[model samples]
Target: MAARILAAALSLALAAMPARVAAALDMAGVFDSTGPEITISWEYLETPGRKAEMQAVIDGFAAMVDNEFLPRDPHAGIEIVMTDDAAHFASYMRRNYPAIDIPKYGVFVSDGRLVTYSRSGVGTVTSLLLPGLLRDGYDDLPQWAVTGLRTYFEKFYGFWETDAAAGQRVVRFAHGYHNPWRLQDIRLLLPDLKLANLVSDTPTVDGTRYQSQQRLLMIFIWKEGKLPAFMAALRARDRKMYPTYLEAVFGQPLEALQPRFRAFQETILAHWNLVMRTPPSQVYADRATFEAMTASVWR
Candidate 1:
């Protein structure tokens, strides 16, 4: 009777403990590096050559942030986690950060940590580094702008595999114009959806497509030497001020620019149709599947 009572008491005590305290991770063969701007925690032991290759990728990413993106020194350096087992990594994150939300693909936590389970590659590196840079450099920018900058970087500097038989050499902008058909879908929806509403609203599949269009629009504005002023207006954080800013930058009122923008959109669609020999509408018609996937991941 006495032994049974003692065992019951111990079980109760264990059950009362916090989940984080109860769930301790035992990571094996983890390798870590602390650089000036980023700290990488790789969850696998790497050989000397592999370590050198990863180090070079990290260094290149740091240099890009320091030179092109970071307007000021980051208050806390970014922490990055690379692992093959995303589910396991997410479980550990949940234990420590009970109140915080974890994104399906890596996320930038409030405390300057970027945890990811992405395979080591140029695309993954770009995905992780771009968010960190945007978070550090333009923390006050709206989500649309932050996401736009990331897509812009990927469109210009990212790589894609061409031939599986030829090993892993990647070519830049391999998708050609960064999701062109998706941009057409956004253009088709624009008469019903306003730009300001699209930016400020919760993310949906259509909203995601709108964001891609906005990014392309921003890139076009940048090419016309108007991005600096436009970004300045966004930094002011007044939605009402956008029309005036748009006029100043584009030399036309918002309504006038729509017709011009529509013309530009048509030209892009025509060019892509000529190259790919497919209608943009038919190509991007599967909205239901895309929305379901987005909802599931975000949920």
Candidate 2:
């Protein structure tokens, strides 16, 4: 009798609340906050310090997006949910987003919301929003610009320091991991891998490689102080006409650029070697150790 009474009272209380508030309550033990560009909600597991740090990262990310990518303010503010438990998050997401496949660590729901099930540490908060940002901004950008800019911002948020130093590290990593095939050989292997093919929403292996190549190209442009002009050109023209615009901006034909691309690859390799020789600093104290412990859950 007492249990029945308690259940009735609970239902009645929920019925009295606004629909949105009631729905929010269904995902119990969540804390919500509103920022200028985003609304964030997280599991109760987040400590005060961590929450503040995440907010700061989000603010910084928003500033970068406004200044670099979007010509107008976003149509809608983004929503973010950080879940403490992976299994629980997955179940909730499956119920809410039945059509989308949920990744183990993060997912961007169709409703312009980002959901992340893992939190490595303070420094890594930017990564949690990246997949969603990439997905959201993809349609508005040209194929070459999408991954290149995404990588550039990733390095920015990951390092949270000066752009030049972060860009150098990103270029080095891309160079170190790239295949040793010549430009002609790569072109043959990925014959259909043109900027037009990247318009498809589905992910593919060839597409991934194309994105990497674009990243390398962006790094080269950045080093040459031509990135701003390149980005302006991208914004002013349509994706189909990007190749023509590219040649115009660089004042060279595609064939003429191959030798310079090869030289850029060699420079990246040299930078990678130099970076690998340097030891890491312990500025974050035990943050690295904490991140390692949480790696299995996220990474």
lDDT against the true structure, each candidate: 0.42, 0.40
Tens-place lDDT per residue, model 2, 8-45, is 11121111111111111111121222224555576546
RMSD of each candidate? 16.1, 14.1
Candidate with top TM-score is 2
| Cα lDDT over the full model 2 | 0.40
Expressed as tens digits, the lDDT of each residue in 55-96 for candidate 1 is 334433343333322333434455555444557557766876
If scored against the real structure, what TM-score would every candidate get? 0.53, 0.54
Report model 2's TM-score to 2 decimal places.
0.54
